[model samples]
Target: MALQIGAISQKGGVGKSSIARLIAREYAVAGWDVKIADLDIAQATSTNWKQRREQNGIQPEIAVEPFRTVTQALKHASVYDLVVFDGKPHSNRETLEIAQACNLVVLPTGLSLDDLMPSVLLAHELVEAKIDKAKIVFALCRVGDRDNEIDEAREYVRKAGYQILAGSIPEKTAYRRASDVGKAMTEISFLSLRQRAEEVAQSVIDRLSKEG
Candidate 1:
């Protein structure tokens, strides 16, 4: 069976789809057959991004498909080495469902309490629903370049009693431009930006390794 990973969020614009594409690209580059289950039916962000990627003739050829339910997406698990579930923008009943189904549930958020509070709340909700807390992880996204702010945010998540990934997706126009052209975060033109994004991707990979 394929290892299922979920990129979930409490709201939009928090880099949920970005993380999903990042994981898909990373595994595909490593020669693993990967597919992104774009569960955001209303936006279809990842599905459209895949179209743009094909237009640009990107390598490795990551696959993406839209599905209305997590159950529907899981049916394709046997076809790929990995299945990334890109959940919708807001928290709902499906949030718990995704958390329950995925081997790892990643919640991406910004560095502010407005983002962190709700993310932590969502994690708590999953735990209350009898989901394993160990399976839930946090990733910082759209973060500013302030070391103090980043450290504080990390501390906040730790205080909330959950593990946060090592690397973060910084707020940069270059990243947005790369995504606009159907490129993953690690595909940015700027070497520094690409490396930083790779670090975030590697952190996810390492977390999955430990899960085994």
Candidate 2:
């Protein structure tokens, strides 16, 4: 069976899809069969990105497909090394089902009360539904230059009793531009930005590996 990793959040613009893409790309580059199950049928962000990636003739192709149901998506599990689910914006039956199915669930959020509060609430809901807390982790995304803000956000996560990633995705325009060309920072020409993106991707891999 393929290892399933899901990026989920109840709020929009939290960088859930971006994180999913980063992790999927990392595994793909490392020679693992990686596929992204784009569950947001309305947006289909990852599906579109995958199309763009192929059009550009990018190497190490990452397969992405849209599915109306989680069950339908799981049918391809036997063929891939990893299946990353880029979830929708709101909590629903699909969201809960993904939580139950994922080996690791990532909840991405910005460093602010508006972002943190709702995300924490959603995490709590997952636990209430009997999802393992160890498998659910919060990823700080689109962070800015304010060190204090990041520090405080980590404190909030700790106090709320949830796991958080050690690396974060900074708010960089490079990230947005890279996606335009069906590229992640790892493929970008800028060495510094590429390293930044790798930090978060590697951190996730390291953490999940230990789960074995």
Candidate 3:
């Protein structure tokens, strides 16, 4: 069975798809057969991104397929080394099932009460549903230049007794532009941005690796 990683968030626009694509690309580049299960049926963000990637002739040829159900996606898991699920933007039965299925559940959120509160609440819900707390972690995303904001966000998650990943993605126009063309963060032209993206990608991969 492949290692399943699910990017889940209760609120929208928190970079859940971006994080999933980033990690999936990292694994693909490392010579793993990586496939993404785009569970966001409404928008199919990851599915469309893969289409753009194919049109642009991107390297490593990551596969992405949309599925209406998590169980349907899991059926294809044995063929790939890693399966990254980009779930919808709501807390529902599907989200809970994805959380239960994944080896790691990543909650991406901005560094603000508005974003943090809903995400933290979702984590609590997952825990209450008997999902292993250690299998879940928060990834700070779309952050600004304010160091204090990141620090405060970290402190907030810690206080809530949730594990936050060491990797984070800053708010940058480069990410948006790159995503428009089906490019992952590690594929950007800027060396610094690519390095930051690699850091975040490797952090997640390392966390998953430790589970093995």
Candidate 4:
């Protein structure tokens, strides 16, 4: 069976789809047959991004499709080595369903309490629904360059009993520009930015390795 990874968030603009595409691209570059199951039908963010990626003739092509339901997306599990689910913007019944279905559930949030609070709450909900806490992790995104703020946010999540991914994605115009061209954060123009994004991706891979 393919290893399933879910990139979900309680609110939009938290880099959920970005993380989804990052993981898909990371695995694809590593020679794995990967596909992104874009579950956010309303926005189709990842779906549209995939079109641009193909249009630009990006390397390590990744497949992306929009699905109205989680079950519909799961149907392709056997066809690929990995399936990354780009979930809807808000948490609902389907959110828990995705958490339960995935080997790893990544909740991307900003550094502010506004973002962190809801993210931890969602994680709490997932735990309440009997999802393994170990499978659920928080990925910091759109973070500013403040060490103190970053440390505080990490402490907040840790105190809430959830693990934060090793690295955070800092807010940068370059990242947004890269996305505009159907490229992921890791595919940005600057090596520094690319390395930062790769750290998050590698942390995710390490987490999955522990699952085995």
Candidate 5:
């Protein structure tokens, strides 16, 4: 079975879909079978993204599906190399299921007070659900130059006692444009912020591949 990494969150508009797409592309480019299960029932971002990719003829890549629940996402746990779930807002039940089904669960958030607060509750819920601390992580996304902002958010999450992934991708126009066109950050030309996003993807894979 391939390693399954879930890009999850308790809030919406926090870049869960974008992170899921890029991570799926990273594994696909590496010749690994990667599947992205969009667990956001209301938005279905990945479902729409898959349609766009097919319409644009994106080839030899991953199989992105719109999965509504944990059972839907885990049906192929023993089949795919990695199944990254983009969980819905407010600690969706699917989040708990995938946490149990995969080796890792990645929670992506921004560095703002509004975008940074709810994660505390979400982390607690995951912990109470019996998600192993070793298999769970927090990834700070849309990290701007606000050093104080970043540091503050980090401090809060750390105080919550959860592991944070090392890389933090800054907000950039290229990422927005790529998502609009259903393309991965690495696939975007003149990616002014490609390194940040790429580093994030790689760091996730490395962390999940490590020896606990």
Candidate 6:
């Protein structure tokens, strides 16, 4: 059975691509075949990264196939254990469509108020589309480990009566460079980020497993 996951957000530049690739890496490391739908054709961040990873021939065994169409991508999701969709960051009709297709849809957000507000709105859209609220998880991205920003963001989400995933991704230069090189955090040298990423990945796995 395939596990389809989509990483989407209403606002851009909140590390949506990073989370998509990270979960792909984690699944691949666990010996599961994974692919990315990669709907953000304009940025093509995940597609470009996929090409680079294929070129470099990294370990942990993964495959990525980029698709521009939602129907085609949804069809492809039937094949792999995991199909991660990196969605366009904004209010997009396709984002709603993607949410409806996957078993679990993750919305990656930062600690800022601006990032939080739109993400909540997108979550609302997902729920209104009749997507199960349990299928949606909030991924806190680019947060400092010790900084108050992460807790603040979590508190805000909680106060708004939304449940967020227990994991948070730290702001790291290594993560940035890894994405630039078309690699996931686990593929990079920084063991700490990789560990954190594993925890994040586990949280995501828990959510998907619970749904299943």
Candidate 6 at 21: error in angstroms? 0.4
Local accuracy by lDDT, each model: 0.92, 0.90, 0.91, 0.92, 0.79, 0.82
TM-score of each: 0.98, 0.97, 0.98, 0.98, 0.91, 0.93
Per-prediction backbone clash count: 0, 0, 0, 0, 1, 0
In the range 1-212, model 3's lDDT, one tens digit per residue, is 89999999988899989999998999999999999999998999999999999999999889999999999999998999999999898658988999999999999999999999999999999999999999889999998988888999999999999999885788899999999999998899989888878887888888888878
Name the runs in model 5 displaced over 4 angstroms: none
- 1-212: candidate 1 lDDT, tens digit per residue: 99999999979999999999999999999999999999998999999999999998888899999999888998877999999999997657888888988999999999999999999999998999999999999999999989999999999999999998888989999988888888999998899989988998899999999768
Clashing pairs in 5: 2-81
Task: Report the lDDT tens digits of candidate 5 across residue range 9-116.
Answer: 878878888888888899888888888888886888888888888788775467877776788667866688778787787756666777788778788888877776
lDDT of 4 by residue, 1-212 (tens): 99999999879999999999999999999999999999999999999999899899898899999999988988877899999999997658778889989999999999998999999999998999999999999999999999999999999999999998998999999988888889988888799999999999999999898778
Please, what are the lDDT tens digits per residue for candidate 6 over residues 1-212? 57788899878889888889988888888888888888888878888887877777777656666677778887867678788888886647888888888888888888888889988888887788898887788889888766677888988887766678787888889888887777897777878778888788889887777766
For candidate 4, which ten residues in a row score worst on lDDT? 89-98
The alpha-carbon deviation from the true structure for residue 50 of candidate 5, after best TM-score superposition, in angstroms, is 1.6
The weakest ten consecutive residues by lDDT in model 6 span 58-67
TM-score, candidate number 6: 0.93
Residue 86 deviation, candidate 1, in Å? Answer: 0.7
lDDT of 2 by residue, 1-212 (tens): 89999999988889988999999999999999999999999999989888888889887899999998899999977799999999998757888989999999999999999999998999999999999999989899999988899999999998999989887788888888889888865778888778878987888899889987
Candidate 1, lDDT over the whole model: 0.92
Ranking by TM-score: 4, 1, 3, 2, 6, 5
* lDDT over C-alpha atoms for residue 151 of model 1: 97
Deviation from truth (RMSD, Å), model 1: 0.8
Using alpha carbons, what is the TM-score of model 3?
0.98
